[model samples]
Target chain A: MSQFVMPSLGADMEDGTLVEQLVAPGDPVQRGDVIAAVETQKGAIEIEAFEDGFLDRWLVPLGAKVPVGTPLAMIRTGDPPATPDIPQPKDPAVPPPPPETPQPAEPDLPPAVPEDPPLAPEPPAPPPEKMGTSHRQRVTPAARRRAAQTGFDLSALGGDRVISLDDVPSAPTADAPKPLSAMRQAIAAAMARSKREIPHYYLSDTIDLTAAEAFIASRNADLPPDARLLIAVLFIRATARAAQSFPEFNGYFEEEHFSPSAAAHVGMAINLRGGGLVAPALLDANEGNLETLMMRLRDLVMRVRKGRFKARELAEPTITVTSLGDRGVAGITGVIFPPQVAIVGIGTPGWQPMVIDGQLVARRVANITLAADHRVSDGHRGARFLRSIIDHLQQPEAL
Target chain B: MNDKDIRALMIRQLGQIAPDVPFDTVDPDADLRDEFDIDSMDFLTLITALGKELGLSMPETDYDQMRSFVGLQRYLSSHVT
Candidate 1:
């Protein structure tokens, strides 16, 4: 049997009313099928089944309020719970999603739960090793089979602990991506501060990327895999070089004063492998040539993803660049990260009809947007800075 | 290597990028991005890994040709000795 819980959609949500049940008992439901709708603080959110099963029974009736994780219904999966018998597609060019449970481990501090300690004597309990050899002997052959069937590594139970049938974990669900609660809070705080403090002005331009695309293709043709540049490298390079001439958009704002840095330390936003976003600085972003810049970007991306980013690299960004070209978004208007006066957003590049020298032809184009602190620089300055970035992208050989 | 060996190696390398995906059920002709929702970085990372494994280079210009499982295997078969 499996559970369909009352899922908490927001951080502050405590409980929700089951306004309606979309599926009745005995209904065969597929994964991702919306089975119920709950009324929370954020209005009605339709909850979906996480596993393929039939609804066996409803634990909570309609109009009942329940807290998050309170199972609303029981589901009959009708088979031995799926173990990690993952079939790797023999000829797959497309890989299967990683067979990993996305849920974070419980916030358990330690295994030091005190079990009826006598305060007067304070004598430590008998060590597991001293009383312990019996614990190993008590392991049933059937329990070992249960552990193996569930793909729970038996060695994980450890030599110190007693093994029991109850200790075997059920099949892990890799269906959902982990919710990054801690990272989400940190992002919320920063963005909230940005909105509260910075008076922002936004500017956008549709720039043709034919020249840049051709340049990257030509350059990457002969380079090794490690040395090759992704299109993001160009976005970073262009933003950094453009910030060189426009000092207003390229510096820190602190203590009611705007101090423009001589060098542009562009913060390139990278989405991590599992989930979450990090924008670490590429030190001396404007000074390096494209080859050197690509090398730095590669190193920074690799290091940040591995959670090995240096303190200085994480903190030294003067301006930020977020490129969403690959995800297929047209444009994004970013809120300026506090203390940084400007952020550049690069949207997806698409083939658009453009007239070049009186001939209408298809060319690669992207929407570049500038969101700057209006307290330091107005729309005129922001527009000019965006224009300069577009100009730099025009001549990739020069940039 | 035989086709079986090549497929096994490809799945293993892809496993590194998408640690939670079920690779065995993916259609060989499906796009990795569409199948597993891998972004550009993951795609590039996969290419880098494939290059390292096969001792070859796949230029950005040729990424589209290697978009599917069958396509990647073909690319490796032709490029690898």
Candidate 2:
């Protein structure tokens, strides 16, 4: 017997609601097949099976929000499907009563802390003037600040329970979409945890993309518009190769130990149409050529926009790359995602005057930044990694 | 087809790719990207849909010629059978 559990998609995710189940009991499933769709604060993600087996049963029901590592289903590996203990009634008129077996002692275990004393005082409730009727309403600190900042009536939330950050609107502008405060809090908490635990070092470089632009333009000249390549694919391909060479930056640092990943699964930060951003991995990125990476990147972007993602794409990113798409920002300094030691960021590529062999010439340049865990790699090695990416970008056809 | 019929078809096809685009307020002469903030993917989808709808083949180099509403119409008119 094997257990299929709810995978923690990212450092910030705690629980995910199972939106759907794509597999049924007794169905044979292969590894990498999408078996379920789990919805997190980020979006709806299609969860994949990690092993080949016959699904025995679903332990979690649809739309149930389960914590990370909570068993979602059971699979039978080597044995035949077990016959259910309780036999179904032959007559449709009479339904059989549920079995009266005693429950396990795990639920009866003592709580982590006694209920006698609280850890800290609850935050001061919102004032009556700020909130219409629910004066002493429970609200998160971030939500409280946002309410105060926007002057939004807390009573308008229409909930008697705790008002979370999701209740607060970033702005009252009619056209602006409601901010995804849950994703924001998740990001904040993870960033805080990363800052507290990982010693992060930052490196930035401006690379000339003249050769890459020409290469892409020629490459796409014959192809249709939908098949054209973007600079992002090049960046991801180069980063994957650089990570292959620099193994130190390509894995998890857990329990005060660094374990490098065998394959380079590069995560690309894709911004959703509605709001928040998600970094889903391109599996075995180092193995693919530019054409493969471009096709995969296109598919990944479309899936992300439509709220469809495989579990492996979410859970197995060894390193992350975030590009501010067409925003024209010169550079960006990124915060490290926890457990993973490194994150690479690429800013917009724009035309700039450059000195080529002492003669001034115009060139398109993009700034690349890397944030690495200091505990796993030093500034010297980090610089080399950045340099490797730069060299790869210059020879665009080779990528 | 006349210009009016071609314009209507173009709008319908563009809407298929970008449903949120405010066709009522869109300027035919202005750049679609500048006016609507359409990214590369959306632009590609719109171009592909137009090509398929009109039975025209548009190479990558001619993408700039199809940037605006009127530009796409002109390109399709010239290239279409």
Model 1 chain A scores worst on lDDT over the 10 consecutive residues at: A104-113
Question: By DockQ, who's the top model here?
Answer: 2
Error of 2 at A193 (Å): 3.2
Two-chain DockQ for each candidate model: 0.31, 0.49
Q: What TM-score does each of the candidates earn? A: 0.62, 0.77
For A1-399, candidate 1 gives per-residue lDDT tens digits of 888777644323456667778886677888878788775432355677878978876777677666777888888787532542334224343234334433322232122223432222221232355553545434455556555444455666665655778876644222222333544544555677788999988899998999998988888899877777777877888888889899999888989999998988898877776556777789888776887887788777766666555434555688999888576689988878777899999898998999989999999999999999988999987888999999989998887
Q: What is the DockQ of the complex in model 2?
A: 0.49
Model 1 complex DockQ against the native: 0.31
Query: What C-alpha lDDT do the candidate models reach, one value each?
Result: 0.73, 0.78
lDDT for position A108 in model 2: 22
Clashes of each: 16, 0
| Candidate 1 docking class | acceptable
